[model samples]
Target: MDIFTGPKLRDFKNSPPHLQFNKYVLTGYRPISTYRDCLQSLFYLHNEFGNIYTHGIPFICFLLVLPLSIPWAEIEWWIGVVHYLACLSPTICSVFYHLFMNHEGGAPIYDTLLCFDMFGVCLVNTLGALPIVHITLLCYPSSRLVATLAYLLLSGYGVHCAVSAQSNVHRLQSFAWQAIFRFFLFMLRLTGAGRGSPASLRLYLTMDTLALLGGLVNISRLPERFSPGRFDYWFNSHQIMHIMVVLSIVYLHWGTLEDLTWLKGYHCPGE
Candidate 1:
């Protein structure tokens, strides 16, 4: 019997090699299979140098929002949902931008996608900050004007950051700039500058300025830039920036929580 004409031979030839050899073996050949490939590819050096960091944002944001779901009588469930959604948006946008923006012949599309990612970050950050400020003010009527003004200014600054960031090619650099803006605001708060108390405000400002400077130092990537690839997988500037961002968000959240707690002790205007 000629093998060429054999039914078994024909079937064998038609079958994929992996399947023919071992049907139980799962070979991921689909487009979505590339996710596993990406995981494996992490160990290797390729164009996806900063891809992990790009994808990690959403994961971290999810973790950040998770705790907010914990029981808090004053915090409406709807508000938690909104906060979660807002926090997740930037991460989702960032992941998509990183995943597809590097496709061949897609530079313009990449730029547009990245712009959306930046905008998402700005919008989400602004959204997250506003609700907290509003809720805080609702608790502390005496601080209503200050909180409202702060919220408006921060929102405006966020919009400015988004626009400026879109115009810049270096996304990380743009993030650093935004961090500086936030640090300035944080400094003002620390100094009691919003309440018109010079002495107390100065002391607070000093502390905030120090924190901001530390954040800047981490974000600037000075030592790493001086020696390319030296701190690639470990303590690079971008990594430091991410850490600082997480810290800043945590601090802001805690501050809001504290304010809310204090407000709960007081009667709003006339109880």
Candidate 2:
């Protein structure tokens, strides 16, 4: 199936300068193609095929199967909705960005796709943590509202920084504020100063840790840097980051589910 066959891919130097963000991925760069051609690339082998499929498969799974796993009837309606979207957002944007990155329109198209990709990540970080705030500050209504509002404001800055950033390092830096805010919430749960599923703290930690590591890995260009060109089509740093991003989202979902379940049986001091 030349569904598996295609035009010979270019080396990193041969690929567009903008798309050569990772010099270590020295070959298999897709040629600039029409949107339809990009769509067709889905069936072929390329460096980004793995990136596209890694997120693509998870996006579909979350869209179709996550609802069954979620305690929709038991959890707050909006929480379920937000969580669902948060779980799905990054992948939806990432698949499109990675697939069409080599669009015939060139760097402008790539930049736009990159912005959209960043926005998706911002959405996941912002939307995913709102419910955690609500649950953690459940007892203190005033504080809950304040914390949620503050976190949202912080995330707004994150989105701005992320979408407008000039480099990968800056892009990852944009998420630091949001991550710090989440760490505070995690501390609350840890110290019993706030409330949540105690079991979830570990999951949340794993989530953040994997996400941070993924970002660093992308920036540092690990295994790929060790052997330029060998990992051009598979196991490249960016691909590894994509996989880690999915795993982080999974942990986010697991931790959220634990909190929702605990919320059902628990109450605040005043309640």
Candidate 3:
């Protein structure tokens, strides 16, 4: 079971420059590794071990189980499809990024992986909200169409900002417009102009709150920063954020499912 038969690990300072992003994680950094060496890492313990499995296990579970829970046949098939992809994207993208971050290909590859990780988050941010938008404007056909198009346009710009952002805070900020847009929709739902299960609004609110908290925790680097090297292979800020991100996705799924099920009984006024 021990595939890490060779290639000793490095310290924080010894790791590749790009891999030194976290000073709090002062040890257990994987060295510049070939493709095979990266694969071998799965069997051994390292700083990224927790990161890899935290998202990796959920990715597999979501892949296998979400489709069964989804209303694929009962609802508009596209909504269910998008929901499924939205649930799975962040985890899979994260797994790859964490797994190969120390690759011999170096910073360019690391940056590409970082872009991919951000892309996954953007997918969830964009596609996950489509159903909410659709349901909110279900009665107002014209507004639904316009809002959907506008949201997609906003998401497109968000993706560009996120991928190009040079800092963590900027990448988090890139999502501000989309979050504001979603908040507007939630307000509409609250005011009864928008339609959805009453329970779903609270779930969506919790989803965003957890995600925002996770982002802030990552940017601020708490707990780990307070005691460097103590959490190198365990409950560090990034790992904590990863857990929060997963929880946030669960809420997104719950809220969307609540709305989707509620959809079966509701019709727009005047329709």
The candidate that achieves the highest lDDT relative to the unseen native structure: 3
Q: What TM value does model 2 have?
A: 0.97
Residue 263 lDDT (model 2): 92
Taking all chains together, each candidate's TM-score versus the true structure is 0.56, 0.97, 0.98
- Which sections of candidate 3 miss by over 4 Å? 1-6
lDDT of 2 by residue, 48-120 (tens): 9999999999999899988999998888799999999999999999999999999999999999999999999
Residue runs of model 1 more than 4 Å from their true location after superposition: 1-69, 139-157, 164-219
lDDT per residue for candidate 1 within 109-182, as digits (tens), equals 65676677677666555555554445434645557667657656756666565655633334334344444544
Winner of 2 and 3 under TM-score: 3
Q: How many residue pairs clash in each candidate?
A: 3, 1, 0
Q: RMSDs, each prediction?
A: 12.4, 1.3, 1.2
* TM-score for candidate 3, residues paired by index: 0.98
* TM-score, prediction 1: 0.56
Worst ten-residue run, lDDT, model 2? 1-10
lDDT of 3 by residue, 1-271 (tens): 3485545778988777899888899999988989888989998899999999999999999999989899887899899989999999999999999999999999999999999999999999999999999998888889999999999999999999999999999999999999999999999999988999999999999999999999999999878999998999999999999999999999999999999989999977677
Determine which window of 10 residues in candidate 3 has minimal summed lDDT: 1-10
